[model samples]
Structure formats: C-alpha cells, structure tokens
Target: MSDPMNVLAPEHRRLRIGDAWRDAASGATFAVEDPATGKTIAEVADADVVDGLAALDAASTAMAEWAATPPRKRSELLTATYRALTERSEEVARLITLEMGKPLAEARGEVAYGAEFFRWFAEEAVRVEGRYSIAPSGGYRILTVPKPVGPCVFVTPWNFPLAMGARKIAPALAAGCTTITKPAGQTPLTMLFLARIMEEVGVPPGVVNVVTTKRSGEVVSALLADGRTRKLSFTGSTEVGRVLLRQAADNVLRTSMELGGNAALIVCADADLDVALDGAMVAKMRNIGESCIAANRIYVEEPVREEFSARFAERMGALSMGHGLDDGVNVGALIDEASVTKIDELVADAVDRGARVLVGGERPDGPGHFYPPTVLVDVPDDARMLKAEIFGPVAPIISFTSDDEVMAKANDTEHGLAGYVFTRDLQRALRFAEGLDTGMLGINRGLISDPSAPFGGVKQSGIGKEGSHEGILEYLDLTYVAIDLPGPARCSGRPACAPAPPGRPTLPTPSRSRR
Candidate 1:
C-alpha cells in the first residue's frame, strides 16, 4: 500500500492560529520530506516574525480566560483531547513516520505514549490543590495556592515529535496556561493535526496556537521580547537550550528545558545476559537511536565483555533495516543527510582511534538518509563518539574493570540525563544507582521514561522536569495568602497582646528601618 502521508492536501498543512488555518506572512512555504524515501511529503506554511507575534497575541488573549476556567472544566477538555488523539492514533503515527523516519510500529507507539500524557494530566488537573495552614499564634491562616504562570511558548524538537510536544503541551494546558507551540519545522504536520483536534474537541478559541518556521531564531526572539509569554518550555539540543536560556534571561521567563543526553548503559558481570542484551538493544536503537535518553555509551564488565559484545553485534547485524513504511523494518533512516554525515564522521573518528567495528558502521549507499545499526568495541577515551552526543544508530562499547571505574566513566560527560545498570546484586545496583550522576536511573531495565514519573536531567542536560505531578507545577505559580483574624485584646501598657510561652524562646521584635 502507498504511504498515507503522500496524499496530504495543501490545506491540511498550513499554520494553525487559534481556530483558523492561515498562510505565512511572506507567503513562503517549506517542504517537509519523508526521510525514509527522500520524497517531499508536504509543504507547510513557513511562519515568520509577524505570524509568531500573532500566535503570541492569541495565546496572551486566551491566557486570562483559560486560567480562570475551573479545574474540572479544564480536566474535561483535556480528557476530550485525549480521546480525540486516541481515535486518530494511526493517522498521526503514520504522519510521524513519514516526516521523521522511525519505524511505523515505533511511530504508532509514540502516538499512544504521546496521548497518555494528555490522559494522565487530565486527571492531574482537578487534583491541583492548595494548602491551608493555621498559625501557631492562633489568629491568622496561610493558604498557598497554585495559579497558571500565564501564556507559554513551547519549542519542541523533531525527535519523538508527537511525544515531546505532548509532554510540554499537556502539562501547560492542564495547569490552565494558554500555549503557543513552535514545533520543529521538520515535524510540524503532526502538531498541526493535534491543533485541529484541540479545536474540534471544544478547546476554546485562542487557547492553543501552533506556528512552524524555518527562521526559528527570529520567531523565538519576537516571542521572548513581546513580554506576554511568561514561560518557555523547550526540548532540543543542549547547545540550543543554552542559547534559549540566554535569550530568556532578558525577560526572566520561566523555563523548563529538556535538552540533550548521553545516557550510559552499564552491564555488570553477574547480569542476566538475555535481559541485558534486550534492554541494551531497545535503549540504544529505539527511534533509530535519535532519543535524548537513548543509551549512548555501553560499559560492560571485563569478565563478560567478550560474550556480551559478540552477542550484541550478532543481534544488531541480524536486525532488518529499510524505509519506515516497509513491513518488518527494525530501523529506519536518519532524519536528514546531515545526521548521516555526522554519524559517519563520528564512527570514522572512533575507528581511527583504535575502535573496532563489530557489525555496522558506514552509511548505506541509497536514496534515503539511511545508516545501519552499528556496534563498536575498544572505543578510545578521546573518540568523538565518546565525548559527543551520537544521535544515531551507533552503539559504542567500553570495558571496565571495577565498579568505581565504571561509575567514574559513566559520569564523565557533561550530560546527566539518564543511565542504565544491569545487575542482579541488590546492593551493587543500589550503590551504582546512587553513585551515577544522572537525574534518572534504570537499575535493571532499559527504559526510564513514563507518564507517571518525572522526566528530566541534570548538569548541562536540562533545567527542570517534565511529566509526573511535578510537571504541572512547572507551569504554575505558588501564591501565598495570609488571612488575619481578630485577636485577643492587648494589655494596656504592652505593645501587643501575645507573650512568650513557658518553655519557648521569645520572638525577636521586628525593627523598623529608618528612611
């Protein structure tokens, strides 16, 4: 059967502003190609600064009304959106595969995973609670309430397009903040379709806006300078994240950054080889190894290094590779030719530095931007793959002698997003888990991300968390209110009625500052 995305009408691929579809200010369009086939799937409107400002204005206008909407009402709307996404899961999944070139099955899984965020946060919305505390002095009460931060700008990346966008948008919307989603130019169609779903599911006009632009810097600058967007939630490269942080500093915008990751997968001598292999394969090669949390470095204990390397290379070599739409394809093409070039460069650097290629390394000579699932052994310390984020289907393995050596090597990078350890020894697992300088750890499993758990990183990986109960708080502001009630009458000669209790220390008098 032909690809579903190949037949997308031009109207189905326009900029979404509030409840309407529109053209770019410059009347320019950019083609979104299928990375698997190297074919142009659709041309979306290329939003400029003018279109970006319009989106910001729409989100700003909707912020007040959306924030005032009751928590239950917002929950209901989110639930409706969730249902809509679930119903159109196949369509959205296909779109994702066509644009970003993950396997169709993985793309479908992405849709399901992405929709879960909305469902989870729908339940989280009504559960947003305020705390009330009675003063020990017995006259005043303090209430801490959570309020929406205001209009937000979500800058999402192309990798795991649907899931990344959902992670940011679901929480922001659940917290009653209007959002202007700036989806990566390569994968805007999926988000545009989601915007359509939002509009159809009775999301009030101007509550959600999506703008796609090749000129992301200009658009982001405009949004930041406008002063209306109070929060900026971004998921992309650590370098771009730093740039965004500096840009946002001028406005002091509240930011939630889920940036780059160089996750380490540690295989111990006593680990279950089958489980370890399966987990490592999934962790390293999921989404063709484009994920930020994908295991980038593999450190195996010296005792089992040879056995593990042989089995891993054989399995990786045996896996199927083709276009995303093809059946039984285990891996798909990289997002673009640039990714292909970079992956080759990194592999060559590693091989030149004494790394041994066990299975695959070179890019396939084909029409698509395809790279084979590669495994390397004896990778040197100075290899570029060891230091850089290899956002591709290349797995480099290193051998370690001791627990301390492995731990030190695992935490050697600037990124601390995610890490994995495979060991049956409970004490060893716990020690490594505690010692690894990463935000999230998988003791025996390969995957770490879940809707119910907080997803983020430390060091240069990112700034704040996404998902879980804490996720909603990133989009909210804590406001404290003190209510003063009538107190006991003061003594005639004293300044106030209250005195020190029998065993308690006397409170210091707050002195007034002289002008």
Candidate 2:
C-alpha cells in the first residue's frame, strides 16, 4: 500500500493553471496545518491576485472549445474521474481527516459522497435537454437551448472539503462550463490533490483550474470582476457570502451562495424518545457539529424536555475524542484555535444567561483545537448562540409549551436552511414540515444530504440549489430561438420574385444550435 503521508509530496503541493504546475508568480506560499495536532503538515503555493487572474484567463481561453465538446465525451470524462477518485479513496480520505479534522471514518464517508457527485453528474450530462414548442403568435416556432454559463468561479469551505468541491465542480463540468476553483486556505490540499486526479483522468487543459491563497479577499475580488467570468459559487459564512454577493453584483454575475444557518431541531410531545435521541446525535454531532444543517437550537415540548435532554446529554458525554487518525475516535478538532475561541464564548454566554451545562462545556487542554461534547439546558432565547451558527458539538435544549410559539421563534432568524422534527404523529409532523421556514426538513431522519437531492436553503441561507438537477442549472443559461414560417407561395410578381433573389427571405433552412 502507498504511504498515507504521500499527500504531502512536493509534487502535490502547487498551483494548477492550464496544464502546468508551478508556484505563485510572487513565490509566496502558506503553511497547511493538521487541525488535530495544530502542526504544519505541508507548505502549499499561496496564490495571489496574479495567480488568480492567470487561472481565470486559462479558463476563459478554454471555455468555448470545452463547451463545444460533445456531451457524451464530457460524460465519459466525468465517469473516468469518478472511478479514479473512488479507486484512491483511502488516500484522499486521509488528507481530509488530516487537514479538515473530521474522524477518519467520517472522512471516508465524505470521500464516497464527494466521488458520487462525479458519478451522478455523469448521468446528468446526457440528460441536459431543450424543448420545442409552438409560439402563441401564428407562423412562428419556439425552441429553448441550454448553454454553458461560461467561465465560473467556485470558492469552497473547509468543512466537508472533498464533498463541497465535488458538489460544485462536478455539475459545472457536466454542464460544459470551464471553471477555476479556489478551495478554502485551511483545507486546500484536498482540492489540490483532486486537481492531480483530474489531469490524470484526461480532463482537457484549462477546463478545470485550482488555486489556493491566504489573500482570499483580494484573489476572489479579482475573479468576480473579470468580464469573461459568468458565474460565482461560494460556500461559507453569511458575512463573507454577503461580501461576495456585492462583488458579484458589480459584474451582474450569476451566483450560488450556500451560506450559514442556525437550524432548529424540534422534539414534539408525541415523539418517541428513543428515536429522537438517536436522530439528535447524528444531527448535532456530525462533523463535530460543524455543519450548516446541524441543529443549533433544539426545542422540546414541555412534557418530554427532561427525558430527551438526559438521554441526549448522556450520548454527547460518552463520545470518544482524539486525533482523527486514531481508531475509535468519534469526534475531531475544530478547524483552528479561532473556532475553539468562538465555541468557548458561546457556551460562556449561555451559562451567564441562566443556562445550565449538563455535561462537558470546557475546551480540552491540548495541542489540538478540540472541544468536548456539551449539552446545555434551560437555554434562554436571549442567548447569542441561538441566533447564529454554533459550529461545534454543543447542544442547547429549550422547552416550549405550544407549537405556534415554537414555530414563530424558530422562524424568527434570517436563516432558512434545514430543520429537524421528531414526531410520531402524522398530522403534527405534516404541519411542521410545511410550516417550518427552511428549505429542507427532516421529519424523522437526521442526515439530510443525498447525492441526488437538491441541497440548498432559502432566504439569507442561500441563493440557489447545489445537488440533483438544480445543481447543474447554476452553471447553465437558456436561450430562446424563434423561426417565422413563410407566407403562402406567391410566384405572381413577374421577374421581381426572381426566386426571391439571393438577398430576399426564402424557404428557411433548419439551423440547429450546436448546443
């Protein structure tokens, strides 16, 4: 077997522009640390605005030819890439665990989830369809063709590094759009290594480019300003997403923002406690609770709050924490010390606001950025964590007496991402399913993401979807074509007709769009 540490090989740590691998024009580089140990694992080229623009130019130059490639050929390329990614799942999964700090088992799941995008989009490539319809106006035929949106920019996040990049890149490639991806600086290796896989799988030069840099604001701003760039897809905090939106607005660029969320998990009175506890663990602790869809504010009906809280807290307290690469470790470190500080402050504020910590709430004393699983009860509404994403393995349970009150409080926030409800009552579940102001609802299940599902939120949470058929739509635009039929044949105008002359309008030949 190949060494797992091979991910840090010199050849794997560089910027990929067109068909070449090299350093930034300024010879700048940055350190990539293993979140589990807070130790430097690799130094990768830190792309500046110079590198970003060069990558964009390469994508623009390769756009038309790639867009013109037959859909079947594109589909074949994506399939090959998917097979290659799956074949090397262990190596890629290790990089994810080392860089992003999810448990090795969880990282393996992410590897499979990431590769699934390429496989799913491969089938979708041949399924990009247009429609033929009769126009309302007589003598005219109407048709619509979907075309590549042109060069695109994808700014991905640290959590779920592999899947996040795959979610954006696979669909963009399947839709025939050339792209330049800037993975988050914290976890750039996964994308960098994926770039190598793309080249090995014979993806044409410049069709897909990868760049990483600490100067994100400057680099991203340049890409958003490029006249040739047609779309922007970003996955990150709402504060940064807003900045990107303003920058993209200046160019009137199409954008897909999968921003932040403060999702609520509701446990109704009729809920099965066993089922609720199981779902709560998965919903609240997955990726150490660093998910946009992770339940941040868990509301329980007054009748079952105590029972639910006790069982849930026991589960949280029992989770084993250690380095991600260690066997049987259920939770891993936060992305960095900053994340540790934020989680600490939130727990402190809640404790100050009359909330009681039932179990672990303190940060562990260690070299890693680790926080123990904590459960806080009697959490007041005024607590700050309720309004923003906790992004940690801390659960705050608030008891409520009525459904209407709970619904109003749940929807009060600007975010409308994912919500969870554990109810055995059909009527009640259906009511909350339609009532909750989130894009996705988990009526019984906890893990909501699926390869074929349309994954995204509404309102401030996000602007567009990222999975299923909608995933491909973000990189495509539709153009309408109309044909006006000729009037009845009239050859009674003497030589004036002259076969309608070369300049005149005659029988129209069917001209099919290359798309």
Candidate 3:
C-alpha cells in the first residue's frame, strides 16, 4: 500500500564513487522495478564507461596509502563497518526485499550473513601470515611475504547483492587493497547503502567505490583494460564468466569467478524419510530456488523414491506465496518475467519428455513475476532441466538405483557447484561425498554455507574459493625472498641493510584462467 522505497533516502540512490554521491557522467538513469508487483520503485543513476574508469582512477590513486596502512588499523576499520551495518540491518533488509523480492525475514538473515564477512575479514586482516622455511640448497633462507594484489574490480549479480559484494569487498579491504565494484543493474541499492556505511565507519575516500550501470559490458571492459586495475572478481552465469575471462585475456589480469551450477541432491534408501524430505526443501527452495547452488536435480533410491516424492510434492504445494514484505509468506516473487519464462520452459520441456507434474505446472495470471511451488516426478534423463540450472520454484525429482549409476548421472553435467546426500550409514555418506564431482557437499543435512568455511565451485562452476582464510588470498600476492646465508653478510652497517644476493630468479605462478 505504501512506497516500499521510502526506506532509502534520495541521496543513497546515486552512484558512490570517490568522495561524491552523484549521477552518472552521461546523465543516464534507469528505473528499477519491483518484481513483486512490476512497479517502478526507484530511478537510479546508470553509470557508463566514463564513470567506471573514473572509479578505477580513484582506486589507483588511493591504493598505495591504503595498502601501507597497518594491519591492525585496517582490522579496526572493517570491524567498525561491520557493527555499523548491523545497526541498520532493519533498513538494509527492507532494501533487499524491495529490490530483490526475497522475503523480509530472509532479507534480515542476508544482512546478518553479509555483515559477518566484514567481521570475519577483520579478524583475518591481522592474520595474513607469511611462511618461513629453510631453503633446500642450504645457501639461503626462504621466506614468503603476502601483499595486496592492488586495486580490484568486482561485478556482482542481483541475487544476494549485499552478501556477494561483502564477500568480495571485505577481503579486498582487509588485505589492504582498494576496490571499484559494480552491482547488478536490477538491485544496486543495497551496495550503495553499504558504501555509505563503510564511509561512515571511516573508509577513506576512493578506497571503495560502487557503480550501478546498465552498460556493464562497456563499463567493465574499460576497467579491465586499464593497466592499473589488477584483478577482476565476478559472480554470475557461466556464459558471462566466459565473456569476462576473454576480456581479461588481453591484459593478463587475474580473475576469480563463481559462475553457474547444476547441483544434485541424492537420498539413499537408508536415510530417514522425514530428514531426507526436510533437506530437500532447503536444497531445492532456498531463496525460492533462485540460488547458484540450489539443488537442480534430486535423485532418490528405488526403495524410498515413492515416499519421498509424495511428501516432497505435498510440502512444495503447501508453500505460501505473496509479496516479500507481507507476513507469513514462504515463497516470494521470481526476479523478473525472464526468470518466470525460463522456469516455465524448463518445466515444459521436462513434461514433454514424459515427466508428470504432481503439484503445479502452469503460470498464474497476475502482475508480479510469480511462479507456483511445483514438483514433477519421473523426470527423464534426456530433459534439458537435468543439464542446466533451474533457477526457480520447480523441483524435478528422478529415481535412482545404484551408487555407480547415480554418480554417473549426477556428474554428467558440465557444472559442479554443490551436491547433497542424506544417508544413515557413515560409509555410504562418505562414499557419496568423495564421489560427488562438486566443490562443496552436504552430508545428511541440506544447509552447507558458513562464513567460516571455504565456499566455491569446480569445473566451469568457478575459478577460486570465496570464504574463510582462502577468500583473503584472492586479493593477495605472495613474494618469496631469499636471504644469502653465506654470501651476503656483506653489510658494513652503512645503510642498516645487507647486500642483495648476486642473481634473482623470477617465479612463475600457475595461471587460473584457461587462456
């Protein structure tokens, strides 16, 4: 009934670059729509190549100073920002629900999850430990120092906008690196607000910047081409990831990509039927099934397939759907009409392949981009849904017989982001965990994401890890130094230093990019 966007002031609806919150240089603006009702909620500054390159310029100018700051001071600043974000969780949650259409309760949980990145990286800032080891040659002592990878550029997706930005920005700042980030065009408000919070918590001007733009390819290409911009971290589709990687090739820039996924959930015959059903709900329907790691294929053993599919279909049919801001709504709107269309096509394709819909299979006539919670049984292997990520509220359940057969079918896809298995026997659980061709696995439980653990994907799914200590490493470069044990005691105390070794060797790092 009310303007949900009243949660954000007019000042926060602009691009955050350097010390100014202003409109794009091109004077272009785009209206962001509310998916729940297809209403224009806000008109945001639409950045272009000029704004993006200007943001990069600011970061390059601030890089040396920010990287030279002491680790403890950086840690304190990040911690303060984390606290500041939590204080405004209610407002931030409202923005997320308004922009992305996730339930308000889930939006609050995202705020909590996102803020923890700042705190987690704050603790990690002071702990960027270097390594010391004796050289095998015995002529020199070897030590490696970790340093920031310099100014970085991040491209975030619309889903979980706050968390994705935080996951990238937190570690970059904690590692003493400056950054320029571009949020998804559809949902940039959270990141704009986050930039304000970081500024209030004492983030130096130009240390962090947010750019919202519809011309992402033009903007990102300019940033990547700039020699000063060192790394590019992106979270989106595998197709887009390949495009960005190709752009990265010309400059030889480092990249970290968390791309597409076709996750599978397997339930063994020995599993508790109730527990298996519950795990399926989480793995299938979290974020209304608009997740990169959301279970796309569900395989149940022959003995329990009937019972599990019946209960699952019943539960899926029972979910409540409405505007995310409404109370007691379990399922929220899809991102947009394109999302609804894609989900509908995937389901239709499966049904054409002889799959039977147990609950819902048709689109509703309404304003919002809403899809009913649907479950289909006997999903054929040749269906296109099995080969791709069905990023919606449709569940396609398939029956399996043996571990070998199931594993072959599960690993058949080109994407391998996450897998889940529920079994009472430890041996069977371990077998699935080991055999699954995925970066992360959930054993006997559905939930697997944790701020303290490493989160990433394998194959075309992603390039590097995103959480825990490994997350910080993405923003850092290691420099190995050798001290000449017998050759370089040649310090006459003239300049308070010893003479360097005769000749230095350049070390080659294994490239993560396929090119």
CA lDDT for candidate 3: 0.91
TM-score of 1: 0.93
Relative to the unseen true structure, what is the C-alpha lDDT of residue 93 in candidate 1, on a scale of 0 to 100? 82
lDDT of 2 by residue, 320-339 (tens): 99989888999999999999
Return whichever of 1 and 2 wins on lDDT. Answer: 2
Q: Largest lDDT belongs to which candidate?
A: 2
RMSD of 3: 8.4
- CA lDDT of 86 in candidate 2? 93
After superposition, candidate 1 runs with Cα above 4 Å error: 6-9, 486-515
lDDT of 1 at 212: 91
TM-score for each candidate, following the candidate numbering: 0.93, 0.93, 0.93
Which is the winner by lDDT between candidate 1 and candidate 3?
3
The candidate 2 region of ten consecutive residues with least summed lDDT is 1-10
Residue 37 C-alpha lDDT in model 1: 78
* Residue 184 lDDT (model 2): 93
